[model samples]
Target: MGEACERPGSTEDCVDDAVCATDASETGDPADPVWETYTCRAVCVDESDCPEGQECRGVTGAFATRACQPLR
Candidate 1:
């Protein structure tokens, strides 16, 4: 299988594929400062590993995607 096809259990296990730059603001202006981007891999191992107000949602290649939602 190809290297990209391999999956990691967690973000710590992910190898950076690219160093993308993201604007610091929502305006999407190029003049804005750039932020480093990490490969979209599992950022957390479990729900408890997520932030206090966020939940982990599974992504295609990532173990989970951290999303914030109101408590039910």
Candidate 2:
């Protein structure tokens, strides 16, 4: 549930029930996919919707996606 949406190329909008978020690190040469910073996390309703050892939690940023993240 960490992939992007249904588009042909870059600059895609999140599909229904998904949100765009960033989690990037510096690359020696940043040019396109060499250093991608955006991710699509699934919006979960509760723990039941998550896999084992994970729980539905709000995404790190101000986004509305509630992804199933591993316990802290």
Candidate 3:
């Protein structure tokens, strides 16, 4: 198994109140490792802090956005 596969439980091990993200590494010409890491909700202070393709929507909390929309 690869490095990523070895840590399948890493995400689940995080505290329930905190968010989790996955850090993946890819092999290529130069063996580009750890290309990027997708964050969950742990490091986010606001919706705008989310990645470009994702959005932070609140239901019973603050009246933030309602859903994640496409980035134009």
Candidate 4:
């Protein structure tokens, strides 16, 4: 895959068809800036598609598109 995405908006630079996905659990809290980080993940068909410690999940808004993510 390409380099890990450092920003929070787009995944155009991610390799291996990966997209930039934000951690849902990390968001919604104005007090936490750590949640602003984005991860480069390939779209997943199931949990198996995710890395060992993560799982495939779908969010509701702009992040709604399914991708590999940490378990919530």
lDDT of 2 by residue, 1-72 (tens): 466533312224665666554443465544442424666655678999877887777765544457665554
Q: Candidate 1 at 54: error in angstroms? A: 0.7
lDDT at position 60, candidate 3:
24
| Model 2: pairs clashing at backbone N, Cα or C within 3 Å | none
lDDT measured at residue 20 in model 1 versus the true structure, 0 to 100: 15
The better-scoring model by TM-score among 3 and 4 is 4
Best by lDDT: 4
Please give, for residues 1-72, the per-residue lDDT of candidate 1 as tens digits: 112222333333334531111113334555763433223322444677555764544443333343222122
Q: What is the C-alpha lDDT of each candidate?
A: 0.34, 0.56, 0.36, 0.62
Judge candidate 4 at residue 4 and give its lDDT.
Answer: 57
Using TM-score as the measure, which candidate wins?
A: 4
Give the clashing residue pairs of candidate 3, or none: none
Q: Model 2 TM-score?
A: 0.46
Candidate 3, position 25, lDDT: 41
lDDT of 4 by residue, 1-72 (tens): 424566544657577657776654444664554455566777777888878987877632336567777666
Ranking by lDDT: 4, 2, 3, 1
Q: Candidate 3 on 1-72: residue-level lDDT in tens?
A: 112212222334344433333333444444444534433333344568656875544322223323222232
Q: What TM-score do all the candidates reach, one by one?
A: 0.28, 0.46, 0.24, 0.58
lDDT of 2 at 23: 41
